[model samples]
Target: MSTKRQLAQQLGVVVGFDDPQAALEQYRTPPAVASHLIHLADLNDDLDGRTVVDLGCGTGMLALGGALRGATRVIGVDIDPGPLETARENRRRVGTKTAVSWLRADATQVPLCPDEPVTAVMNPPFGAQTGNEHADRAFLGTAADIADVSYSIHNEGSVDFVEAFAEDNDGTVTAAYQSSFDLPRQFEFHDADSRTIDIELFRIEWA
Candidate 1:
């Protein structure tokens, strides 16, 4: 297991902790998603010395994982300043070899290099709380607009939603992975039950 995975297992770290700010201060990492992200990075064939941008990069899980996996440069962007600050601190603590940078910006409107080839990865909000497909679609559209390839994670039942989003943006699904994510009790709207939900990671390219 990777160091981060081992640490996550030891600490019982899960995605969407009860107190995100406090969890971030504790340097909690999302192990399952991080492992999946590493797999995505390896699948990219072009990952070596490539530029990568991670949107909604919580606690630097994906960003730091990309750095460790030999990405030449990794930029993590998030709207929440608290998580961004935690990611910065974790980057310093790990002393990642690859150049890692953090930016606090709205994921939907951040400026990106349109001419340069880049890979974008993100774990966007599931939109379950508000059932707002527009937000998810907008995120995918923004990603397609800026990057040559994009990998996004969403709820398992959102396959149709993603397909429609890709279609709307003239993009194609290159790959996908379905896996379970353990969300913390505090993050779920349901009672104090273990929040294990299936999620899908999709790799999309411009059509």
Candidate 2:
């Protein structure tokens, strides 16, 4: 059996969100985003023994990557159960020695440990939904609330959006990187006709 298939079997059945295939179809992480995350984590000297959170952690790619990079503990959080199940299965398949945990919860209302500092990485929804502006704002607001320092992914065109987020929370963008990604057919709203989508990865710190 393929590794992914074997993982699905070992994880039993997922509830809430659709099965693995559906989840993959609708919510796969873009390769550029993944690469940027890994690069940012590698550049940070504090990641070796720190706790990190992967918000909107579809399939745990970021979380697993963090573990491989020597984080003391990596937590993957998502609202949907299917993605959580897939993340757990991926964790098992990779078989890393670093600690990894998956939590099924809304990203906007993450329950965090009060005493420990956390570094978070997230690729939040980019307000592409026709009428879901509020959802996207809430997601960003929650991200700022939960971490000491954060690296967030957003569309390159969202300069105003990012600036507003930083302004609202007394944070500043310490660094930014650009990544280009292909839009998957499942997310047709992205509407790239053979063109790569430009995305920005911003390192944010509160003032």
Candidate 3:
């Protein structure tokens, strides 16, 4: 029941680097987009009283948003230590009492508690950068391995790929939402101030 503005307020207060390593694929998820994805997952009745994992969580947008949205527990996992530091700071700033845990580890390698039904939400790399192809596949495959339901983001062009990937991993795409993903020029790769890419939020449920 949180408003987008309210969610943004909670996430926008935190700060992060505009661009980080391409291997990490660390584009900060926009506040509105993070809110929308989390909202959609909540609408699907997938979050309340559940342990929510924010894989590749950058700056804690999805983690903090899920905490704010009444999740029973929230774990923000990332391979990079920098963003995980930022996530800790953001967690302290938000002051959410939802049993939040920040773990610095690869999303595909993170350990899950046994007998706990987990749900994952992430805005992973779209695999556009050099040497980073099929990055989203790892995240989706890991979610399929450990999560009951997952909400993930991908480029519009990868719609067919995502669907097939989900099906192949014992999950089904129950829903997909399209939105304009704003990409600010962060890296030194000659570009404009910002650009918008068509992105899709896919809701995948384990079969």
Candidate 3: how large is its RMSD? 1.4
lDDT (tens digit, per residue) of candidate 1 on 12-67: 33233224642122223356666666666565654575777887676677777677
- After superposing candidate 3 on the true structure, give the runs of residues whose Cα lies further than 4 Å from its correct spot: none
The estimated TM-scores of all candidates read 0.82, 0.80, 0.95
The TM-score of predicted model 1 comes to 0.82
Alpha carbon lDDT at 59, candidate 2: 78
Least accurate 10 contiguous residues by lDDT in model 1: 10-19
* Clashing residue pairs for model 2: none
lDDT of 3 by residue, 37-75 (tens): 888878878889798999999888898889988899999
lDDT, candidate 3, residue 6? 78
Q: Which segments of candidate 2 are over 4 A away from where they belong?
A: 1-26, 187-195
Q: lDDT of each prediction vs. the true structure?
A: 0.68, 0.67, 0.85
Can you tell me which runs of candidate 1 are displaced by over 4 Å? 1-29, 131-134, 187-190
Leading candidate by TM-score: 3
